[model samples]
Target: MKKYLLQSIRLTAVLLVLLCVVYPLIVAFAGGFSKGNGGGEKITKNGKVVGYALIGQNFSKPEYFWGRPSAVGYNAAGSGGSNKGPSNEEYLAVVSGRIDTLLKYHPYLKKADIPADMVTASGSGLDPNISEQAAIIQIKRVAANRGLTDRAVAELVVKNTEGPLLGMFGPSVINVLKLNLALDELKK
Candidate 1:
């Protein structure tokens, strides 16, 4: 019985180490290879890399289409929502403050023109994409700021907007990094 108990303990330790440490390390290493040497490196133009696609970033300028509100301020390690219920005072305050800020920044727009994504932080808080409607909502502001025609900006937005994955999963979304890069390219 003593020998059997010792064998079981050794087996459990081995399995635990394999599952908790070795497996994850192997998977992470393999995934790193798939992403190339730079891993999370952002693609660039004019020798300037702008941002990563996996992380959300602030775009407060009128010339750029803004991404969703990030609860952790786009910190990938801190990916998570506020987890506040709809009726929570903190959540309501945040939403209200965002709306006010949006209004202040875009005084020319009516209340209805603002997209919900503009005021809401996404679930992961590190979402790099925004809804198509959110991108559309900022078209006029960005176009005017960049001195581009609305049609041109709209076309660019449409081009950057990615469709549902596998043509059936997830919503149509736009990567802010890619879209902003395209916008910068237009100026060059």
Candidate 2:
């Protein structure tokens, strides 16, 4: 029993150093190699930092593609879901309102046709990407509002889509900010 206790204590000490110290250092070092060098990937326009590539922003204009609904109002400092269950009345009402808004902007979209991500906030609440279907559903509205052909707007969506991880895992997603930035750059 005495030997086992000493072994367990030593193992705990080693794990603490590895996990609490070494792991964080490795992660921080790796982050330095990322696009923003431990910060977020900042997207710039007209020599100004417009937004970060990884944080969601609210885009309510009909001409822009809307991102996922945010529970914390897209506040990166307070990233979280609503924590409301599906059956909760408030949650249902919120989703219904989102559906109504989508239908208002996209009269052709049926509630059944809307993607889940379109009406629901992601777990992070600050998800920068939306499913491909969500972007596709708004193509007609965006084209009509921007006076661009549907084909052109659809091309933007395609161009902005980020494929599955290494092309083998997860579904495709579109970064809404990048897509909108590209849209703004399109010749009207």
In model 2, which residue pairs have backbone atoms overlapping below 3 Å?
none
lDDT of each: 0.84, 0.91
Query: How many clashes does each candidate structure show, in the order listed?
Result: 0, 0
Q: What are the per-model C-alpha RMSD values against the true structure?
A: 2.6, 3.0
Report the poorest 10 consecutive residues by lDDT, candidate 2. Answer: 179-188
lDDT of 2: 0.91
Report the C-alpha displacement of residue 69, candidate 1, in angstroms.
1.2
For candidate 1, write residues 70-95 as lDDT tens digits: 88787777788877888899889989
Model 2 alpha-carbon miss at residue 46, Å: 1.2
70-163 per-residue lDDT for model 2 (tens digits): 8888987888998999799988998999899889889998788899999988898889999989999999999999899999999989999999
Cα-lDDT of candidate 1: 0.84
